[model samples]
Target: MQQTAYLPLALALAGMLLSGPVLAHSEQHAAQHSAAIVKEQKPWGIAGEPGQVSRTIEIGMSDQMRFSPDQLEVMQGETIRFVHRNQGKLLHEFVLGTQADLDAHAALMAKFPGMQHDEPYMAHVAPGQSGEIIWTFNRAGEFDFACLIAGHYQAGMVGRIRVLTN
Candidate 1:
């Protein structure tokens, strides 16, 4: 009977202890959710509206760390619908950013192999599957796209995009 009395207290204590991590996870999730709702303008450009897409470009990703038609050219203010088809056996992602930004992100990905991120300029594709990113090239400059999946970036799974001024 006395032992049964302690069960409730022990359960409460356990619940309190576990709540810390649960709260942390909830906070992290909330932050990520809020970030998704707020679109920040990047140096490359802003996210494109699906209805405003000017053209569509299909890109292929393979296990060999290569992107078919790796070089791309776009005119400023053009909204592009980037369709990414992953031909490789591994999971892949297409992330558009400046070279420096991609390099930094790659380093982070190498350190945290299981990190999860989402943005308008990124598309995570599964093997034998497809994903897409609709982006507007409002800024005229050279930018980069890459698969910053752990060692994928190091293996040269990167591409170049040239946004010509209109």
Candidate 2:
């Protein structure tokens, strides 16, 4: 009877310990899914088909708060592949949106530093790592790409993309 009583207590303790990580994983997964849904709904641009990529633009992110070729001009309805490489020794992200959207997102990021999420319009790159974002600029206007990592955006880590009429 002593062993039986201890068994329930031990199992309860194990469950408590295991549940923390499991719950955290679930929360992260949910946040990522939410982000994807929002991305799909918003009209920044549509996800580009891999077969429809018209050109590839390689961008490099660095510790100096900058992106190579910060200004991009694309024709409306053109699809482009953005290859992002993190050449810096810090975590960085390439998020594409309008200036207003980026500002709001950066504020949210500053408020919740631990927030974890991903979408097709965002590439979270670690130091010396690389990622890609393929997008179709069906809308004609100006968009932006920025590293909204707290102080990074304030430090001039921003790029512009202008979609021109074909």
Candidate 3:
């Protein structure tokens, strides 16, 4: 009779232990997602407001590790909606940053393959899906975008953006 009574309590303890990591992961993801929504200014630009978007650009990602129309031109101070379509069978991401920043990030990604990050200037797209990043090119200079998913960046999945002075 005592063993039967403890059975339910033991199962509850096991459930709690098993759920601890899952809950922590969920909380971490929520925090990251929330932080991403906060608009922050970068040397390249700030997170764009939908109402201020000047135009939309569609870019394609494929298993070949290339972005279609990889070279892009944008006028400084223009807000653009970047639509990333993943036509590949694997997950991909579009991250905009300076070349130095990208190189450092790619190295980190290679070291920690399971690292999860969410930023206003990045979009993670799943296979056959799409993602978007609205950004304002407030600075005039050259910039870069790439898939910093471990081996993806090494495979030449990169693009260039020239923010021309207006």
Candidate 4:
């Protein structure tokens, strides 16, 4: 019959139209996955805009109850590369937050392993070991970094971070 005669032509036209968009979509998806793989291999960082001002600083914590430099000053909204080295016999945490925040969190820390050192904002460095953290203190305030190893902070192991006005 006349209707059945156009079956082959209709099928061919439908396949051609579908293939065009399908091929383009598959190629775009492949490119996106490739780009994501490259990003995963990079170092620790605070996400920011292009050409943003930033700097890296090395901080060391020791058993002697101290953080090297004692006090740190940074510009508001600037990135800080924190490299923490623990030269102490016990585990140490390089936490950045207000003094009250540290104190409040300290009590609940014993529930977790490594003193919550595995947080994205902190890198727990064991004795004689090294690690890094990327922190951006976007506001001007006083933050205290301490090794809340029970008696550590009480023995004066706390340090100060001063983020300057914008």
Candidate 5:
């Protein structure tokens, strides 16, 4: 008798579910209005927008041997602000380059602890120190950034920058 009593309740549940999808179609009307607004707005700003330091890039290095962001991008002649913090026990340097240039510069920097690279966009932050490097991308290309500290680069303290064409 109890089992039979459940049959009507189950049938009501089935009917409700069958009609549930039809009720959901009404939501499509509200979503279409928002989609139209998105199609008209450019979140990244309009084309030909001026490139400047409307913000800064904050990065952190740690004692465990890591960089907050191992990759970056910039535009030609755009001033980028780097707020780098050395959260590590040792020193770190943000040196920019191509693989070949880094290899060559690394070799030359071997003689000196902090003086060998030619291309700019380099900064060395000591432990517990905060440093900054502001540079404008003058060319469009990919560049490698690495910490030239004694054995840090070998341990993989490197990143890349994709500077887009102006």
Candidate 6:
């Protein structure tokens, strides 16, 4: 009779304990959303509107550490929707930024290989999955996009983007 009375209390305590981890996970996801908003306002370019897209480009990633048509050219002020397809058997990402930014991010990724983060200019694509990122080339300069998945970057999984003036 005493054991039965304690059962409800025990289950209640267990439920509370389990909810702590779930709450933490939710907070982490919220943080990622905030970071993405911050990224959208940064100098690389504002988040492009789908209706304003000047062109659409399809890019493919493979386990061989290569991107199809790895080099791209766009005019300044052009908005592009990049359709990224992962053909690899492993996890891949498409991150767009300058060489310096990519190098910094890659170094950080190497240190925390299991870290999960997102930005407006980044897409995390799984094997045989597709992802999209809409970006505008507001500045006239050279930029880079790469998969900064630990050893993936070291294996030469990088591409170039050049924004030229009209």
Top model number, TM-score: 3
Tell me the whole-model lDDT of each prediction, alpha carbons only.
0.89, 0.86, 0.91, 0.67, 0.65, 0.86
Model 4, runs deviating above 4 Å = 1-53, 110-117
lDDT (tens digit, per residue) of candidate 1 on 54-100 = 99999999999999989999999999999999998999999999999
Sliding window of 10 residues with minimal summed lDDT for model 5 = 40-49
Report the C-alpha displacement of residue 84, candidate 1, in angstroms.
0.2
User: How well is each residue in 77-141 modelled by candidate 6, as lDDT tens digits?
Assistant: 99999999999899999999888899988987786576667677989899999999888888888
Total backbone collisions, model 5:
1
Q: Please identify which of the two predictions, 4 or 6, would achieve the higher lDDT against the true structure.
A: 6
The candidate with the higher TM-score, 1 or 2, is 1
Worst 10 residues of 3 by lDDT: 18-27
Which should have the higher TM-score, number 2 or number 6?
6
Error of 4 at 145 (Å): 1.2
| Clash counts for all predictions | 0, 0, 0, 0, 1, 0
Residues 1-166, candidate 3, lDDT per residue (tens digit)? 7899999999999878866665675567679796647777888899999999999999999999999989999999999999999999999999999999999889877855776778889999999999999999999999999999999999999999999996
Give TM-scores for every candidate, taking all chains together and pairing residue i with residue i. 0.80, 0.78, 0.81, 0.63, 0.60, 0.78
Q: Of the candidates shown, which would achieve the greatest lDDT relative to the real structure? A: 3
Cα error, residue 29 of model 4, in Å, equals 31
Ranking by TM-score: 3, 1, 6, 2, 4, 5
